[model samples]
Target: MAAVPLSLQVGERKFTTTKATLSKSGFFSALLAGPWEGDLLMDGSYFIDADPDIFDFVLKYLRHGILPLFYDKVKGHDYRLYLAVLEREHILGHFASPFHKISIIRKRIDEYGFILIWEARYFQVESLEKWIHDKTYLKAIKSTHRASEVDRIQDVSRSFSSELDVEYHTSWKTEKIYICPRRIFVHRGNPEACGRQCKQAQGTAEPEYEEELTVKALAIEKETTFNFEICMDDDR
Candidate 1:
């Protein structure tokens, strides 16, 4: 007997595809490999509860094996906001370049001569000389105590606005970018044992979301070049 092509409903939008395409995802392949012993929906289509607009992007990859050209079709003010949906779908990295913008930023930083530090925090500067050595688990010192505006979850890492600048004696500066402090989940460990004691000092708070860092780099400069690394972040 010939196999049935799988029919799916993602966020009210329906689509049909062969087993070969859907199986590209280990999650789906494993699901279909077994029996349909349980009752499916009356409509006979498997429903995937996900962001409808975002799934369109995933569908592109599943059907064509390429990133969606309509990256902006999803509703959101933030440019990289769609990435969170991709991460949940579990196929975030199955592409030629998952973080296209981040790749660009990294390339430009490399073209110059600055060393890129991967996980920069807001309180990790040289000021805490004594606390640094004696403390068993000093919370990653953030470089500063001020409010930072790298709000978009993705931009939190990719925004180069306030990051440590490469000191190559080059006069040109990149566009005003926000710096992404390596965010540490302060409450992850025991509160009392924390060297900074930030958790015990403050009460529990609401949940917060994280973004995958992404950016493209380069600001034209005055006849000078510097090499650098962008210890950037990725969802994968």
Candidate 2:
């Protein structure tokens, strides 16, 4: 007598299967092993395994919630492949990548829950210091403080910004591009801690202050590059 196939239901949908055979082997072994038990459900339908690799890929994504680096090879080392996998796996709400346009990434993140962005340089001590000094002095004058207090605050802000800039530049040279997930819950309460954690997670060192600041500044500059473009064809 032949054995009956295993059956499972996820939400309102049901799946019945006899067994799955694994042909191509790699990180997707467990997902192709059969008769695999349990029904994987997302969005409303019971997810099905048609092509075992794609199915394994989807299952791995559903279970681990991340696209493996191998899949990213499809996009010529770009994040687009990763993005596609995220969409397929329904796990796009967990990453951010700055390499893609911010507006598009933001939209995807808002609608899908997360997006991936390549880490870019995002800070400049001079600009931040200037803002801080102006704000600090303006606050002192409004509070009826003496001119000396205003000057002192300005001096402190300038010095701090300068020191921070130095540290930022030094660090930037030693670090790699940082990648982070877009989901805040992944870090639990401290999104600021993402930088450190990402470096550690990627087996890299925390950048020195100068490098971090330089990268931050660079990111800001890159974002505003379009605004700085001159129109050569403008009517004189």
Candidate 3:
């Protein structure tokens, strides 16, 4: 069969692309084939006859690397096919985590960068900070001076003030910065229990829970001290 143009609309956003080769294979067969399950017409219509929840889940997986639990054993083959497609698209990792597929999340970061990923999720700056902290991914670099030394330096700098020095030489100053250490978040609940519950909710009478994945950046710094001078002269 000839390939057709496919268009998809999620919320107010619209995406247009060529239909996959399997579009002519009928909906069930196409779904079993994977990836093609998300194909659409140029007019924002889909050929697959799936329920809204399943369709939405597939779309979410495509856009955000999130996979909802599949409940029905009869639908297992189809669901696995969908997952395979997601894996191929680099939207999910090879292994499943507590909340998501780690590989897919990593791929999204690799492809879009952290800022974009956060932006796409509509996350607040505080959420970003919390995410980093909760994930243990970023760490703040600490001052090298001892507590006493830092206190002494601050006191001395705060006390000394000279007009002549202000005009010709500026005093030295110091501050701290942070960096990411790179860590992964493990799920808190039992994997089997979560899965089973998730599946049951899907009307499949089975149990399955979607995995959750968390991230955190680690921080590192050195312990030491150094002296420096600053020149504020306007002319040589």
Span of ten consecutive residues with least summed lDDT in model 3? 116-125
Q: Which ten residues in a row have the lowest lDDT in candidate 2?
A: 219-228
Best by lDDT: 1
**lDDT of the candidates, in the order given:** 0.38, 0.31, 0.30
Residues 125-183 of candidate 1: C-alpha lDDT, one tens digit per residue: 11111222233111222233233333233443333443333222213233332212223
Q: For every model shown, what is its TM-score relative to the native structure?
A: 0.33, 0.17, 0.18
lDDT of 3 by residue, 132-178 (tens): 32422112211232222222223333422221111112234442321
Could you arrange the candidates by TM-score from highest to lowest?
1, 3, 2
Candidate 2 lDDT over residue span 1-236, tens digit each: 66445443422345444333111212123334443334344433323322233344333433332323331111323334334443333322232421111222233556435554422111111222232323322222111111222212223333322112211111233333333443334553344667755656546544332222222221111110111112111221
| Candidate 2 global CA lDDT score | 0.31
TM-score winner between 1 and 2, please give it. Answer: 1
Off by over 4 Å in 3: 21-91, 95-114, 118-236
Residue 24, candidate 2: alpha-carbon lDDT: 21
Order by lDDT, highest first: 1, 2, 3
Best by TM-score: 1
* Candidates 2 and 3 compared by TM-score, better number: 3
